[model samples]
Target: MAPPSFVSQEEFHAFHTIDRKLYTLLVINLWRDPVESMQVIALWLWLERVGFKNVVQKILSLPYILTNELADEAVTCLNVINNDQLASLTEGNDTPLMQSLIDRDLSLQFFDKHRLIATQGITRIVNEVCIRALRDIMQHAIERNAAQSLADSQKVISHSLQQPMVQPGLPQVGFGPDADVELPWTQESEVPPDDRTMFVTFSKGYPVHEWEVREFFTRAYGDGIESLHMQEVPPDEQSLFARIVFCSESAIEIILSGMSKAKFTINGKHVWARKFVPKRLKPSLPAAPPVNLPV
Candidate 1:
């Protein structure tokens, strides 16, 4: 059905009033809906820019920059600083990074001319901030520019029917279902038990509930993994999750595969079952070479 339109000024006013009221309610209630909260912050920011109070602008912008959804927007603001806005704001002469670097250089120059080294610290702090900003900008720019290249490179290549079947781990695997074939995991027992049990461990400090994990697995891998048991690590533990058991190899494969899809990792490294080695299996390595050697 077609929606009603607010064509008149009075109708528009009423709509705006309702929208603002709802947004205020959400904020007051501490709503966790990030997208909605971000939109409210954006609305407030716009209003502030159009001659609202400076204090209110500061307040609204703080949450906007700090909130997860709006953090990307904050990064966008940082990009503007790196690109030109902050420079233009600073008497149209210096950007934050540029000002830091130039200020340091000037301080160093002053010290050098006066035969003094006391200004070195001032130069060091300024130089570091400037360098950090420059590095950040470079990273942002490179990632920005690479988006197109990444998309282009992701295009699927046609493979001939006569080609031999390559293994899953190899680069020759096509970007299709064949690339996602489930690895084999079987028990040695001749007759498998009717009830299979899986072990699951979650990292400490994870906000998600145990039942959520089960639901996630159910949706991600239907009938693949069965009967998940969650054991919570200590609150002070570094890892958010760990120590899971699976009744069968199939269940383990399903769980691991789902984990990979969700980008869960150990220490920021992608872990696949085939690539994962137990600590016992990992060979002890020799100690590192001495940092200082005799000349």
Candidate 2:
């Protein structure tokens, strides 16, 4: 996508809510074919040029939003970044994200307590970085949780982190009209069925009713032929909690893409039958012989 008209932080601030669908499409397209990586980098520099040291801070400050396919796509974006880029992005002392990744339980607790609402006045680059951090943390949490039962979880986790094919109809960065244009189709599944489950949780205080759980599954699955199941377990004896599980990966993607209404404890410390294992990515284009460009 050609970069969207440079939106000012003040304008982003005026809008209190994010259109989850729109943002998801934008982010996914950007991640897939990043013609404007330099543009986004420029935007980040623009904010820095204007003396907004807190721009990154503001972007990172967004509470995690459970809407659209964003939570998933955010993870995909992080997966694309090279280790050098990730290291450069994470220059800080607290490193809450790194800490969260090292320990799944702490990350879950942190996400449970803090919620991402909207990015008001935060620069786009900063927003991307923040979301990337959140996704990476969750990805690690999922991996750690699955490690407990590695034999079973490997396939599930592998499928969850699978890369999507660039279809012809999808809105690509250079192939699109508006850089931030929203795609019309439903979000496709990156991971196939049999290797996935959507693990939704009830808050410690509010337990999900059996009826609500049934409806949640029904509504989440839509017209898909996947069987979803829920299990209730307490995190601690003192805690009354439950997990609404969708044992099909396609079903999980369906639920995440279509429904974002019901509030559930996402990023919890549960055994996800899926994890992320990174592999070297081959360049899409053949390398050109070394050529010097005029200075």
Best by lDDT: 2
lDDT of each: 0.33, 0.34
Model 1 CA lDDT for position 117: 28
Top-TM-score candidate index: 2
lDDT per residue for candidate 1 within 64-138, as digits (tens), equals 212222222233333342333333321221111111212222211222233222223323423432222122323
Model 2: residues >4 Å from true position, as ranges?
Answer: 1-194, 220-225, 232-248, 258-295
Candidate 2 local Cα displacement, residue 295, angstroms: 69
RMSD of each: 24.9, 20.1
What would you estimate as the lDDT of candidate 1?
A: 0.33
Work out the TM-score per prediction: 0.21, 0.23
| Collision count for each candidate, in order | 14, 7
